[model samples]
Each structure stands twice: as C-alpha cells, then as structure tokens.
Target: MAQMTIAEALREALREEMIRDERVFCIGEDIGIRGGWGGAFTVTLGLEKVARERVIDTPISENGLFGVALGAAIMGLRPVADVQYGDFLFNAMDQVANHIAKIRYMSGGKIKVPLVMRAPVGATGRGAQHAQNLEATFLTIPGIKIVCPATAYDAKGLLKAAIRDDSPVLMFEHKLLYGSKGARSESGAVDASSDIPDEDYVVSIGKGIVRREGADVTIVGTLLMMHLALQAADRLAQEGISAEVIDPRSLVPFDWELLEESVRKTSRLVVVAEGPKTGGIGSEIAATVSERMMDYLTAPIQRVASPDIPVPFSPVMENFYRPDVDRICGAARKTIGD
Candidate 1:
C-alpha cells in the first residue's frame, strides 16, 4: 500500500488506463504542455513524457475538444476529456448535455460513449466564473454518470472504473480536497490522501461507502462536503450525536439502498453539498429520501448548501458560502431538533 494524494492517485490511474488500453487517449488544454500546471492541478504532469500521443493537448475550446472526444468515442476509442474548471462545463453543454448524452438513446442503444469527463470543482477565490460546483447541473441528464470521489483511494478506483465502463462518465474532483502540492496546491486544502492498494481494484460506479458508522443521524455528502461531513460527525460525537457519514461517490444511479439503510438506523438525514440550495443535488437527495424512506425518517430531512447566488471572490464570503463542518453540524442538529 502507498499513501497517495488525490492528484497523484488520479495521474497514476490515467497512466495505468492508457497503458491498459491502446485506444484510451486524453484530450484537454494544457494537459500535455511542456511545463504547464497539467490540466490546472498537476493531475496530468509528466504524463506526456510517457504517453505523448495519448495525452493530446488542445486549444481552449471546450466545445470543440469535447466534440472531438465524442466523435472518437463513437469510433470505438476511449477518450478522457479534461476541463480546467467545473464551471467551464457550461461552454460544452451542447456537446455534453445534448449530443454526447443523447447519442446512445438517439441511436436506439446501438452506440456506446466510452468517454470520461474530468472537472475540478469547489471554491478557491476564483469568483463565480471558475469556482462553481456545477455537478448539480448534470444530475438530471440521462446518459452521463456522475462520480465525485472524496479520497485518493476512491479517485483511483472510480477513475479506473470510469475508463473501463462502456458509457459516458463525469468525474468531479474537489480542488480543496485534491491534496495537490507545489505550484498547483490549493489554499485551505483538506487532507484527502488515502493508502491505495498496490493491486488493481475498482469502486463500483453506483455504490456508496460509509466512512463513519453511527446511529443518531445520517450525513450524505459528496466531494469536499464528504470530508466536511466526516469532520462534522467527529465533532457531533462529542455532543452524544452519533452521525453516520456516507460518501455517495456516484450521484446518478445513486445508491438509494445504502442511504436508506443508514436513514433506517439513524432515523434522521442531513444532505450536504457545495452547490446552490434550490433545484440542486441536495434538493434531489432530500426529495428522494422523503419519497423512499419517509417512514424510516424520524425528522424532516435537512439540506446544508450555499444560497442560490454566484460564488463570492472575497475569502470571508467564500468560506461562509461553502458548506463547512460547522454548517453540516448545524444542519444535523436542526434535522434532529437538538
């Protein structure tokens, strides 16, 4: 076993995937640059030296690059497309939410899009344009699968699974939880490193993991919110609140069974996310739990998320805007009416 940062683990996964599949290539801006930040976070640094042809750099056209990836995917090639920031996904909405996501259904299940889309999300003082957590926007999209891994172990495993899968997959990496180092390291970064297994393994795309087992309340979170939820669980434990922390790595095709199991035991649920409150992933989770596990829930479901406003540039407001340990704990208490 080896302790690896999120960036390192992801780079390792990309390297392995390319080696495992001759047709697996990467398309993104600055990823294969001579000395760039390696797709904005060093996740692809030094990759070009080994996989030069596979790690193809592109212009700053998200729509164009993603269109090319979709074309290659349809041609029986696995393309891992990278977006510098999660917010930029909007620029490629036509290619992503429209064409690529609809081709299989449009073709009556005769085609498969073995494409992996990677985007780094979370607030880091980049203001509204680059710091948005846009995962919620694609949750309702039918074809693409979403995976937001919080730990290095999950990053590697889920990424491998995404590459091998026969359908389109979206992987959202948290900027603050990447554990990136050197010039690409993030301020206020959390320790999300994990001891990755030496042998190959894959975390199933639709499964959720219980990071902390408890019985008082269940906290469901993704990306950096997952880390914060676990921290909140630790703090709430001191107050005699046993919070069960769950990392729903895969969003679409969500593991409702695992979450229902936790809600059944805890009899309380608090969904946390960094996205906006309204019509967001949290809203869907709360509604889903209310519909599926209403009888199991002893209290009204609560959601902790940012307001429906653009992300702030100021450090103070940005910190207040994103869901933190305090915010999650408060939501847990509110759900239980403590």
Candidate 2:
C-alpha cells in the first residue's frame, strides 16, 4: 500500500492508462513543459517523463485545444484535455456541447469521442472567475458524461473509468479536495489523501456510495460539499438526529435509485452544493425527489447552496458564500422538522 494525494493518484491513473493503451494521450496547457505548474494544480506533474509525446502541452487557447481533442477522438484517439479552471469551460462550450458531446449520436453510432476533460472547481478565495461548481452546467448538456471524485481513491478509479468509456466524459475535481501541494494549495483543504493499492482498480461510474447510514434524514452532496455534509451528519448524531450521507460521484448517470431508497427510509431529504441555489444540481435532485417520491418524504425537499452573487475575495465572505457544516446541519434539521 502507498499513500498518495488525489492529484498524484490522478496522475498515476493517467500514466498507467497511457502506457496500457497507446491511443490514450494527454493534451493541456503547460502540462508537458519541463518546469510548469502541471496544468494549474499539479495533477499532471512528471507525466512528461514516461509519455513525453503523449503529454502534449498547448497554448492558452482552450477552444483550440478542445477542438483538437475532439478531432483526435473522432479519429479514434483518446484525448484527456484539461482546463486550467472550470469557469474557463465557457470558452470552449461550443466544442464540448455541440461537437464532443453530440458527435457520436449525430454520427449514427458510426464514431465515438473517447475524450476526458478535467476541470478544477470550487470557491477558494479566488473570487468569481476561478471559483465555480460546474456540475450544473454540464448536467444540462445531453451527451456528455459527468464524474466528480471527492477522495484520492475515487480520483484514480474514476479517471481510469472515464478514459476507458467510449463517450465523452467531464471529470470535475474540487479545489479543496485535490490535496494540491506547493503554491497551488487551496484554502480549507481537507485530508482527502488516501492509501492506494498496488493492484489496478476502477470505481464504476453512475453508482452512489453511502458514506454514512442513518434513518432520520438523507443528505446528498458532491465534491467538497460532500465532506461538509459528512461532518454535519456527525454533528447531528450528538443531537439525537440520524443522518444518511450519499455521494452521487457521477452526475450525468446519477444513481437516483440509491437516493430514492434513502429517501424512502429517512422520509426527509436535504441537498447541499457549492453552486448557486437556482437551477443547480441540488435543485434538480430536489425536484426529482419531489416528483418521484413525494409520498415518501415527510418534509419538503431543501437545498443548501451558495447565493447567486459572484464569489467574493474576502476570506470571511468566501467562507459565508461556500456551504459549511453548520449550514448543512441546519438544512438537515429543517428537513426533519427539528
């Protein structure tokens, strides 16, 4: 067994995948350079050593890089593209939404875009531009698959799964959960580092893992917020309230069945997120629960999320903007009529 940070785990997965499959390659900005910051978060550090030609660094053109990746994928090459920040995904929206996502279906299954786009998201006092929970944005797109890994083990497993899948996949890694070192360290970083096994492993996408089980209320969260929800569940335990925490690691092929079962047992639901309250993944999950399990719910579905305003620069304001354990606990309490 070896301990590794989430960033290192992701790099190992990419390295192994590229070695295992020649068609798999990496294309991102500053990733293959000798003395670069490893694509903004050090996830691709040292990858140039083993696969120099496969780890292709690009200019600062996100659209151009994505277009190149889509073209390469259409030609039967697997390209793992990285965006410096999740917010910059807007720069390549056309390539991701219209081209990479729909290319397979539009081609009548004649082609497959085996592309994996990685983005780092979360409000870590970086103001608004660099801080965004992008799950909601990609969930609206039809053909793109979405996976968010919260732990080092999941980071390695899910990245491998995304690379092997035939459809285009978007993997969003939270800044606070990346365990990034050096100058790229994020504020409020959790101990998401884990011990990885020597043998190869892959976590299946579209499955929900229950971090904690309880009978009182179901708390659903993803990425950084999932950690906060677990803390909230622990705090609620002292107050005689049992809370079940569910992490829907994959958003596109969401494990709704697991959530429905949790709601049926708990009879209450609380969804927490780092994104805006309006039209976020939390809102969509809440609406789905209401539509599918209205009779099973004892209280109305509630969501704890950041406000619609831009993420602020002040530390105090940023802390308030992001969902915290106290906020998650409050939402769970309200859901259970506490």
Candidate 3:
C-alpha cells in the first residue's frame, strides 16, 4: 500500500485500464504532450509512454472532441474524453445531454456508450468561468451516470469502474480535493490522500460510504464539500454532537438506501454542498429524504450550501460563498437542537 493523492491515483487507474483493455483510450487536449499540463491537471501526465497511440491529444474543441468520443463509443471503443474545466462542459452540452446520454436508450438498449468525460470542478480562485460544480446540472439526465470521488482511494477505484461501465459516465473532480503537486498544485488544497491498495479494485458506482458514524444527525456531502462535512463533524463531536458523515460517491445512481438508513438512525439530516442552494444536489437529497424517511425525522431537514450567486473572486468572499465547518455545524445543531 502507498499513500497517494487523487490525481496520482486516477492516473494509475487510467494506466491500468488502458493496459487491461485495448479498446480503452484517452481523448482530450494536452493529454499526451511532453512537458504539458495533462488535461488541465497532471492526471494524464506520462501516459504517452505507456500507450503512445492510446494517449491522444486534441484541439481546444470541447464539442468536437466530445462528439468523437460518442462516435467511438458507438463503435464499441471506450474513450475517456477530458474537458479542461467543468464550466467548459457547457460548450459540449449538446453532445453530452443529447447524444452521449441517449445513445443506448435511443438504440433500444442495443448500444452502449462506454465513454467517460473527466472534468475538474470547484472554485479554486479561478473566478466563475472555471469553478462551477456541474453535478447538479446532470442529475435529471436519464442515461448518463455521475461519479464524484472525494478521496484518493475512491478516485482510483471509481475511475477504474467507470472505464469498465457500459454507459456514459461523467467524472467531476474537485480542484482543491485533487491534492495536486508541482506547477499544477492548488494553493488552498485539502489533503484527501489515502493509502491505495496494491491489488486491483473497483468501487461500484451508486454506492455511498459512511466516513463517520454517529446517531445525533446525518450529514451528507460529495466532492469538496464532503471534506467540509467531515471537518464539521469533528467540531460537532467536540460539542457533543454526534453527526454521521456520508459520501455519495456516485450522485446519479444515488445511494438512497444508505442515506435513508443513516437518516433513520439519526432522526435528523443536514446536507452540505458547494454549489448554490437552489436546485443544488442538497435539494434532491432533502426531497428524497422527506419522501422516504420523514417519519424518522425529529426536526426539519436543513441545507448548508452556497447562495444562489456566482462564486466570488476574492478568497474571503469565496469562503463565504461556500459552506464551511461553522455553517454545517450550525445547520446540524439547528436540525437537532439540544
């Protein structure tokens, strides 16, 4: 076992998957260039040496690049299309929402879009154009699967699984949670690193893992916000507030059973997310919890999320824009007051 960051772990997964399957290849901008930033981060660095032809580099055309992946997927090739930024996903909306997601269903389940779109998300002082969390954008989509891995272990495991999955999958990686290093390192990075296994592993999509177990309240979060929830949980523990922290690694195929069971145990729920409050991921979780576990709730469900506004450019305002430990802890306290 070795300690690894999310970026290193994902690179390893891609390398392993490409070696295991000749059909697997990466298609994106700056992925294979020597001394270049690997697809906006270093996740694809040094991949060219492993599979020269498979490590493809493309022009700065998100729509065109994504379309090629869809075409390849239709022909039974697994292509990992990398978008430079999550916000740039808007450029390829038609390809993703219209084509890649609906190919299998439109073909009456005869086709499989075994394609993966990797995008780096979350605000890292890059202003609005590059910082948006796009998970909420695809929650309602029928065909595409969404996975957001917060830790190094899940990042590697989930990426491996996504490569093998037969449907279109969107992988949203958080900038701060990447634990990136060198020139591509983030200034205010969070250490979500973990000791990855020596053997091959795959974290099945649609399953949620409980990071911390408690009985007073259940706190749900994903990606960067998942780390925030764990921080809040620690503080809440200091105050004698037992809060359970859950990481819904796969957002679309949400682990409703895990959430429902945790909510039932705690009888209180507070969801934390980095995106805006309106139509945020918390909205769906809160709604589902109310629908399925309302009987177990002792108080109204609370949500700790950003305001319905653009992420601020200033670091202080950015911190204020997103949910923090104090906010989450307060929400938890409000949900289950002493």
Candidate 4:
C-alpha cells in the first residue's frame, strides 16, 4: 500500500488505465502541456510523459472536447475527458446531454459510449462561474452515471471502474478535497489521502459506504459535504446524538439499498449537500427516502444545503454558502429532535 493524496491516486489511476487498455487516452485543454497544472488540479500532471501520444491537448472549447470524446468513444476508444471547472459543463450540454448521453439509448443499445468525464467542483473563491457543485444538474439528466470520490482510495478505484464501464460516467471531484501539493495546493484543503493498494482494484459504481455507524439518525452527503458530515457525526457523538454518516459516492445509480438500511436502522434522515436547497441533490435524496421508507422513518427527512443563489466570490460568503459541520449537526439534531 502507498500513502497518496486524491490527486496522486487519480494520476496513478489514469496512468494505470492507459497502460492497461491500449485505447484509453486523456483529452483536455492544457492537460498535455508540459509543466501545466495537470488540467487545473494536477491530477494529470506528468501524465503526458507516460503516454504522450494518448495525452491529446485541445483548444479551450468544452463543446469541442466533448464532441471529440463522444466520437472517440463510439469508435471504441475509452476517452477520459477533463473539464477545467465543473461549471464549464454547461457550455457542452448539447454534446453531453444530447449526444454523449443518448447515443447508446437512442441507438437501441447497439452502441456504447465508454467515456469518462472528470470535473472539479465546490466553491474555492472562483465565483459563480468556476465553482458550482454540478452533481444535481447531471443527476437529473438520464443515461449518465455520476460518481463523487471523497477519499484517495475511492478516487483511484472509481476512476478505474468508470473507465472500464461501457457507459458515460460523470466523475465529480471536490476542489478542496483534491489534496494537491506544492504549487497546486488549494486553500482550506481537507486531508483526503489514503493508503491505496498497489494491486489492481476498483470500487463498484452505484454503491454507498457507511463512514460512521449510528442508531439515532442517518446523515447522507457526497463529495466535500461527506467529509463535513463525518465531522458533524463526531461532534454529534459527544452529545450522544449517534448520527450515522453515509457517503453515496455514486449519485446516478444511487445505492438505495444501503441508504434504506441506514434510514431504517436510524429512524431519521438528514441529507447534506453543497449546492442550493431547492431541487438539489439533497432534496432528491430526501424525497426518495420519504417516498420509499416513510413507514420506517420516525421523523421527517431534513435537508441542509446552500441557499438558492450563485456561489459568492468572497471567501467569507463562500464559506457561509457551503454546508459546514455546524449546519450538518444542526440538521441532524433537528431530524432526531435533539
């Protein structure tokens, strides 16, 4: 096992995937440039040296990037497309939402799109344009799988799995949880490193992991919010709250079985998401749990998320804009009547 950050583990995953499969390649703006910030967060830094021919750089066009990847995937190439920011995905919605997402389904399952889309999300002083948590937007879109990795272990494993899967996978990485080092380090970065195994492995997509087991309430979160939910669980334990924390790493094919089991055991639920409260990921989870497990729930499902506004540029407002441990703890307490 090797201790590695999320960025290092992801870089290793890309390297291994490219080596394992001849058709696997990476395409993005500034990704193949020598000494660049590895597609913004250093995940692809130094990868051009490993497979220079496959590390294809493109113009600053999200539409063109997705178009190229969509065509490549249809032609039996596994393309890992990178977006410098999660918000840039809006620029390529036609290709992503229309072509890449529906080509296989529209073709009656005769075609496959083995494409992996990677983007870094969360507010980090990049303002509304560069820092949107896009999980909700893509989750609503059908025919695409979404995976959000909070730890280095899951980061490596999920990317490997997404590359191997024959479906278009949207992988969202939290900017603050990347654990980038040196010049690429992010401010207020969380310690998301893990002892990754050297052997080949993959975390199954559409599965959720229980971060902390409890009996009073189930707290569900993803990406950066998952880490904060764990911290809130620690604080809730001190007050005898017994908040169970769950990280639904894969959003599209959500692990409803694991979530149902937790909600049944806990009898209460609190969903924490980084995006706005209205029509957010948390809202979907809350609504689904209420619909399916209403008989087992002892209290109403609670959702803690940002307000219905664009991400603020100010660091102070950004901090207030995202969900924190205090907000998670408060939501958990409210769910369990603490």
Candidate 5:
C-alpha cells in the first residue's frame, strides 16, 4: 500500500493502461512536453518517459483536439483527451455530443468509441467561465458515460475503468479535489490524497460508494460536494443526528439500486451540488428518486445547490454562491425533520 495524491493516482492509471494496452494513448494540450503543466493539473506529468509517441500534445484547440481523439477512437485506438477546464467542453460539444456520443448507436453498434475526456470542474474562485459546474450540460446527452471521482483511490480505479470501457467516457475531476501541487494548485483545495494499494484494481463504473453510513438521512453528492457532505455528516454526528453520505461516482449509468436502497433505509434524501438548481444533475437525481421511491421516503427530496446566477467574482460572494458544509447540513436536517 502507498499514499498518493489524486493527480498521482490518475497518472498511475494512465501509465498502467498504456503499458497494458498498446491502443491506449493520451492526446491533449501541453501533455507530454518535457516540462509542461501536464494537461493543466499535472495528471499526465512525466508520462513522456515510457510512451512519448503515445502521449500526444496538441495546440490550444478543444474542438480540434477532441475531433482528433474521436477519429482515433473510431480507428480502434483508446484516446484520453484532456481539457484545461470543464467549461471549455462547450467548444467541442458537437464532436463530443454528436459524433463521439452517437457514433456507436448511430452506426448500429458497429463502432466503439473507447475515448476518455478528462476535465477539471468546480468553483475555485476562477470567476464565471472556469468556475461553472458543467456536469448538467453533459448529462443531457446520451451514449457517453460520466464519472466524477472523489478520492485518490477512486480516481485511480474509476480512471482505469473509464479507459477500459468500450464507450466514450467523460471524467470530470474537481479542481479543488485534485490536490495538485506547485503553481497549478487551487487555493481552496481539499486534501483529497488517500492511501492506495499497490495491487491493481478497478472500481466499477456506475457504482456509488458509501463514504459514511447513517440513519437520519442520505446526502447524495459527487466530486467536491461529496467531500463537503462527509464533513457535514461529521458535524451532524456531533449533534446526535446521523447522516449518510453517498458519492455517485458515475452519473450516466448511475447506481440507482444502491441509491434507492439508501433512500429506503434513511427515508430521506438531500442532494448537494455546486451546479445551478435549474436543470442541474441534482434535480435529475431528486426527480428520479421521487418518481420511483416516493412511498419509501418520509420527507421531500431536497437539493442544496448554487443559485441560477453566474458564479460571482468576489471571493465573499463566491463562497456564498457555492454550497458549503453548513448548507448541506442544514438541508439534511430539514429533510429528516430535525
């Protein structure tokens, strides 16, 4: 067993995958350079050592880079494309949503786009553009699997799974959760580093991991919000109110059975998200739960999310805009009739 940061864990996953599969390679901006930032957060740092040709770096062109990756994937190559910011995914939406996502289904299952798009999300005081939570935008499109890894272990495992999966996968890593070192470090970064086993393992996609178990209510979150939910759960524990924290690692092929079971046991649900309340991922989850298991719930499904307005530029307003542990705890307490 060894301790590693989320960035290191992701790098390990890529390193192992490239070694295991000849078809697996990386394509992004500033990746594979001698002393680059490693695709924005240093996840691809030092990968040029083993597979320089496989680690391809391109210009600052999201659309062109994604187009290249999609073309490569169509030719039976596993291409992992990295975007500096999750928000920039909009630049390549056509290639991602139209071509990459629909190619397999449109071709009547004749093609397999085994491509992984890695993007860093979350409001790390990066103003409006870079701070937006882009998960909701992608959740609308079909055929692409979405995953948000919350810890170093999950980062390694889920990334391995994403790389191996036949369909196109979108992995959204939170900027604050990367535990990135040096100049790329985020100011509000939480220590998402974890002790990872040296043995090879893969966390199944579409599975939710229970970070903390409780009886009062189930708090569903992903990415950085999952960490905040855990913190809120700890604070709730001090008040004699138990809170169960669930990280839905994969969004598209979500573990609904697991979430339903948790909701059935807790009889209450509070979904916390950094995205906007309207048409957000949290809204989808809450609606699905209410539609399927309304009878099993003792309280209404509450969502604690950012306001619909753009993320504020001021740090004071930004902190207020993003959902915090206090907001999550308050929502959970209200859901459980505390």
Candidate 6:
C-alpha cells in the first residue's frame, strides 16, 4: 500500500480506468493543457501523458462540454466529464437534469448512459460564485447518482466505481480535502490522504462507512464536514461523550442500514453538512431518520450546517459561514442534552 492524497488518488483512478477500457476518456476545460493546473486542483495534473489523445482539453464552455460528454456516452463511449468548480455545473443544468439524467429512462431501459461527472465543491474563500456545496442541488435530480468521498482511499475506490457504473454519476469532491500541493494548495486545508493499495478495487456505491464507533451519539457528515465531525468527536471525547462518526460516501444511494444501526445504538443523532441548512443534505438525513427510526431516537436530531446565503469572500466570514468543529461539537452535545 502507498500513501496518497485525494488528488493523486483520483488521478490514479482516471489513469487506471482509461487504461482498463479503451472507450474511457476524459473531457473538460484546461484539463490536458501543456501548463495547466489539471482542471482546477491538480486531479488531472499529469494524466495527458497516460493517453494524450484521450485527455481532451476543451474550450471554456460548461454546457458544450456536458453536451459532448452526453453524446459520447450515448454512443457507447464512457467519458469522465468534470468542471473546474462545482458552481459551473449550474451553467449546464439543462444538460445534467434534463437530457443526461432522463435519456435512458425515456428510452425504456434500453439505453445506458455510463458517464461520470466530477466537480470540486465546498467553500475555500472563492466567494459565492465559485464555492458552493452542490450536493443538495443535484440530490433532487433522480437520474443521477451522487457520491462525496472524504478520504483518499474512498476517493479512488468511488471514482473507479462511478466510471464503471451504467448510470450517470455526479461525484462531489471537496476543495479543502483535495490535498493539492504547492500552487494548487488551498488555505486551511485538511489532510485527507490515505494509504492506497496497488491492486484494483472499487467501493460499492451507496455503502456508508463508520469512521468511529461510540455509544453516546451518532454523527453523520460528508466531504469536508466529515473531517470536522471527526475533530468534533475527539473534543467531545474529552468531555466524556462518545460520538460515532459516519461518512455517507454515496449520497444518492444512501446507506440507510448503516446509519440506522448507528442511530439505534446511540439513540442520539447529529447531522453535519457544509451546505446551507435549508433543504440541505443534513435535512434529508434527519427527516428520513426521524420518519423511520423515531422509536430509537432519544432526542430530536440536530443539524450543523451553513446559512442559507451565498458563501462569503472574506476569510473570517467564510469561516463563520461553514460549520466548524465547535459547531459540530455543540450540536452533538445538544442531542445528548448537554
């Protein structure tokens, strides 16, 4: 096993996938340029050398890129499409929500759009336009599968799974967790690197993993928030609180069984998400858990999330905008009547 960052692991996954399948290729803006930063944060940094012809660098048009990827997938070619920032996905909402998501269903199961769309999300002082946690936005779209991998191991495994999946997969990668080095490095980034195996492997989509086990409370988080939850768990431990942390790698096909089992054991729940609180991923998890596991819950489920406003550009304001370890700890304590 070799230690790797999320960015390096993702690049490896793309390289291996493209090598494994001739039909697999990558298309995006500034991805394969001679001196590019590898499509925003170094994920595709040196991939062109693997397959120059397959690593296509396109013009700065999100809609056109999605259209091209959609067409390629429809024709039986697997294209891994990506955007520099997840906010750019809004520019191609029609292509994603309408055509790319509905074509197979409209065709009565005969068509399989095996395409993977990767987008870097989360706030990192990029302001409102560039930094937005889009998991909630795409979660409403039925035809697409969503996965947010917070660790290097899960990132590599899930990316491989998404590339091979027959349905369109929307993968949300956190900017601060990319562990990009030097020029592409982020401010106040968290370490999400892991020791990766050389052998080929895939983490099944929709399966969640328990990051930590406890008997007091269950805390669920994804992407950057998952790291914060772990940090918050450490702090709560000092106060004699045992908090279980869960990372739902796949958002669309959520791992309800794993989540329910944790909630049953702890009888307390706190969902932490980086996006806005209103209609956020945390909201969905809390609502669903309440509806199905109300009997096991001892107290009302708590949610730690951002406000319903655009992410601020100012560093101080941005820090306040996203949920922090303090916020997560407070929410966890609240669930346990602290």
Indicate the TM-score of model 5: 0.98
For residues 77-185, write the lDDT of model 3, one tens digit per residue.
Answer: 9999998889999999999999999978988989988999999999889888989987898997889999999999999999999999999999999999887788899
TM-score of every model versus the real structure = 0.98, 0.98, 0.99, 0.99, 0.98, 0.99
The stretch of ten residues in a row with the least summed lDDT in candidate 2 is 30-39
Model 4 C-alpha lDDT per residue in residues 72-93, reported as the tens digit of each score: 9999999999999999999989
lDDT of 4 at 322: 89
**Residue 225 accuracy (lDDT) in model 1:** 90
Best by lDDT: 6
Candidate 2 positional error at 89, Å: 0.4
Model 2 TM: 0.98
**TM-score of predicted model 6?**
0.99
lDDT of 5 by residue, 1-338 (tens): 88999999999999999999989999988888886678789999998887889999898889989999999999999999999888889888889988999989989999989999999998888799998888988889999899999999999999999999999999999999888898988888898899999889999999988899999899999989999999999999999889988898999899998899899899999998898999998899999998999899988899999999998889999999999998998998898776
By summed lDDT, the worst window of 10 consecutive residues in model 3 runs over: 32-41
lDDT of 1 by residue, 1-338 (tens): 99999999999999888888888998998998886888899899888866789999998999999999999999999999999998889999999989889999999999999999999999998899989898888987899999999999999999999999999999999999888898788888999999999999999999999999998999999988988898899999999899999988999779998999998899999999897999988899999888887788888898899989999999999988998899889989987887
Q: Report how far off residue 101 is in candidate 5 (Å).
A: 0.6
lDDT (0-100) at residue 157 of candidate 5? 98
TM-score of 1: 0.98
Separate clash counts for every candidate: 0, 0, 0, 0, 0, 0
lDDT (tens digit, per residue) of candidate 6 on 1-338: 99999999999999999899989999999998998788888888888888899999989889889989999999999999999999999998989999999999999999999999999999998899999999998888999999999999999999999999999999999999999999889989999999999899999999999999999999999999899999999999999999999998999899999999999999999999988999999889999999999999999999899999999999999999999999899988898886
Report lDDT (CA) for all predictions. Answer: 0.92, 0.91, 0.92, 0.92, 0.91, 0.94
The pairs that clash in candidate 4 are none
Question: In model 6, what is the error at residue 131, expressed in angstroms?
Answer: 0.6
- In model 1, which range of ten residues has the least summed lDDT? 42-51
Q: How many residue pairs of model 3 clash at the backbone?
A: 0
> For candidate 3, what is the lDDT?
0.92
Cα deviation at 143, candidate 3, in Å, is 0.5
